[model samples]
Target: MKVDYIIVGLGLAGLAFSRELEKENKSFIVFENKSQHSSKVAGGMYNPIILKRFTPVWDAENQLKIAIPFYKNMELLLGNKYDYKVDVYRLFTSIEEQNNWFAACDNPTLSSYMVPKVITDKFNGIDALFGYGKVTHTGRIDTNKLIEDYHFYLEKSNKILYQDFEYNRIDFNENKIQYKNIETSKIVFCEGFGIKKNPFFKELPMQEAKGELITIHAPELDIDFVLKSSVFIMPLGNQLFKVGATFNWKDKTSIPSKEGKEELLTKLKSILNVPFEVVEHVAGIRPTVKDRRPLVGLHKEYKNIALLNGLGTRGVMIAPTVAKELYNHIENDMLLRNEISIKRFENN
Candidate 1:
């Protein structure tokens, strides 16, 4: 079959690009093998402020401006409650940390999201001696729900093929590429950790980090906002909280390990004083880059082959903006930014 494009993967990156294609009335088919876990098992939190160093995320404002409306429109189409607006409270451990919190609020970029005052209110299960710093305009998108519903939509529309896409099978014609029986003008690889298997773009510098999260049933810990300490505690409703994310550079696999679970529980116990049981444990490899920028652009040798990946830990926030950039770069002949463009690694 002939099509405008063939998207290999259905994660956040692939989904965002598909929307871009749909907006332009472009015909495309997506191939999926369910090999990636990062998008499916993501924490799905979209916080502009990087709590680790209390700095503004790179292009946070612009990303949110496009992302918020993008997901809202998806909800209207799919008729599912996926985007949730939740507040994030960064718990302070020491007086010095509290001072840093207030100091960060003075940043012009950070001032919009950072609340100057420390939240001194008591929480039942959390131990906050120095209070918490609240960050506004933050929320979580249920990525799992979004993926499932979107796949259903794609299936209903007969736009997605549920199978592994073999790169070696691709036959480049004069203007189009043929993969098995299908021919397309372009093929964009949105593969997450699966990019390693891609011969065309696998040589690009990519550092994969395996992250694990646990869902706990904490009935006593009543909190409305997402709590960030050593680990993040995100409220998942029905007396459940999704706490994550241990970044392991050593472990490349997506299987949840005992060591990973122990590490989370140890950190969880330090900040939380309530009794809780682990209901679910999941692991996924985040497609991270050394420079912490997304991988977007077409292959240097093959113009029709493109990529959208390495979104790191903030895939939910970065996907829509980068996808739009990639689409415009390819279709409109617009130049890609040097940082995210694959040209940066061509010299390597």
Candidate 2:
């Protein structure tokens, strides 16, 4: 079987790239090893606000503009409802922090989302902090639904190969790449943290981290928006909420651990005043890079080979724009941004 592009990994990056290729009416095939991974387990929150310092996220405006439309178009194309643009209520922690936020609201960047007064009595079951403010233009994608729909779409199109991609099976040539008995003009690796084994791009700075999340049935918590303090509490419908996740930079394993569970339970006890039942637990490694940016470009020595990984923890927000940019660079003679290009580490 021959195709214009062969994408490895069926995560957000791979799916986003495939969607772009489909838009351009190009041919491609995708491969996936696992049935579920990081993308499926993600809460899919696209927030413009960074809660730590209460600052705006990187390239928030451009990324949001590109992502919202892309996901909406994908929803239309798939004939399914998946993406939703909603407002986020950021619950304040302390009086000092609340004052700081109100003061910062005058800044040009935050004026659109910040409110003057704090909200005190909107929620139930927990002692109110200073107050809560809203972050406008926040949205979320139904990642599991999107992945399932795309998988079915790929199967219907006969463009997916389900198997573990062994590194040794791939044979690289000057103008093409081959794996097993299949060959393609170009091969793009979107293997997420699995890229650590790719001989061509292993030298790239990858700060792989494992994240764990737990699901609980909290009937008393009727909040519709995401709540954050030490850990985020995101509603998952049916009186269920997802409270997670612990970030372990040292351990990159995908296996769920007892320590993670205990830590989450401790955090949950501190935030919630209602009765809940523990339901599910999940763990996955994020393909984070050192500079906290995606790595997208052709191999320095291999022209027909490219990489589209390192989306980090923000894969939900970053994948669409990066995939579009990568598609253009691959199909056209365009150059990738120097900050994200693999060329940055060529001499290292």
Candidate 3:
């Protein structure tokens, strides 16, 4: 079969790219190996504020502006709301930290998103660490539902091929690329950590890290917004909460570990006074780059081949803008950002 583009991996990057292509009435095919992975498992939080040092995220304002509209449009197309706009209550752990947050809020750069407020009586069994600040306009994507709905849409449109990609099956010619008997003018890889095996772009600085998360059913905690201290508690409805995510830099295994569970349990105990049941545990590797940016560009020698991976943990927030940028570059002869282009590793 012939198509305009072949997209590998059906993660958020692939989905976002395909969504854009569909918007422009372009033809494409998507290949997905697994039904679930980092994208679906992710809490899908899009926060403009970085709490660690109280600084704004890079280009957050523009990213959020593009993302909010994109997801809303998708929701309209799907006839179901899949994204949410909510606030994040970052719990403070100390009086000193509270004072520091207040000071930081006064900074013009931080004041818009950060609201100085002490959350005390919001929930039951709450230990007053220090206080909390609200991050307005923060929200999460219901990635699980989005993926399912998109998969169904693709199936209905007959645009998805569910199989493991075999590199040996791909044929490259001077003018085109073919994958498993399907010919396309260009092929883009959105394969996440799987990019490590792509001979063309393996040299790119991708620091793949493993992350583990657990689901807890805490009926006593009626928190509607995301709660964060060291770890984050995202409300998943039905008195169920998704808590997690321990980052393991050295280990890249996707299997949940006993140590991960222990870490989550320990942290959960510190924040909640109510009893909860551990329901689910999962782990996946994030396609993180060393410079903490996405890698998007065409192969120097093979102009018809491109990569659209390395979204890291912020794939939900970054994918829309980057995909739009990539689409413009491919269709209108625009330039990819030097910081995200693969040229940086050419000499290495």
Report the C-alpha lDDT of model 1 over 1-348, residue by residue, as the tens digit: 989999999999999999999999999999999988899999999999999889999989999999999999899999999899999999998899889998999999999899999889999998788999999999999999999999999999899999999989999998899999998999999999899999998988998899999999999998989999899999999999999999999988889999999999999999989999999999999999999999999998898999999999899999999999999999999999998898999988
RMSD of each: 0.6, 1.5, 1.5
lDDT of 2 by residue, 1-348 (tens): 778888989999999998888888888888888833888888788887787677888877788889988888888888998876666766687888888788878878877766667777657756665777767778778888999899998999899989877777878876777777787898889989889778888889998888999999988987887787788888878998888888999887888899999999998898888889999998988888898889999887778888999898888889998998888898887888887787787787
Tens digits of per-residue lDDT, candidate 3, 1-348, equal 999999889989999999889989889999888833888888889998888778888778888889999899889888888887778988887888788788888988778889876666657756765667788889989888898899999999899989977777878877878787898998888999888778888888988888889999888887888888778998888988889788889886778999988998998898898989999998888889998989998889888888998899799889999999899888899998887778777887
Could you estimate the TM-score for every candidate?
0.99, 0.96, 0.96
lDDT of 1: 0.94
Minimal lDDT window, size 10, model 3: 120-129
Which of the predicted structures, 1 or 2, would earn the higher TM-score when compared with the native?
1
What lDDT, from 0 to 1, does candidate 3 have? Answer: 0.86
Candidates 1 and 2 compared by lDDT, better number: 1
* Clash count, one per candidate: 0, 0, 0
Best by TM-score: 1
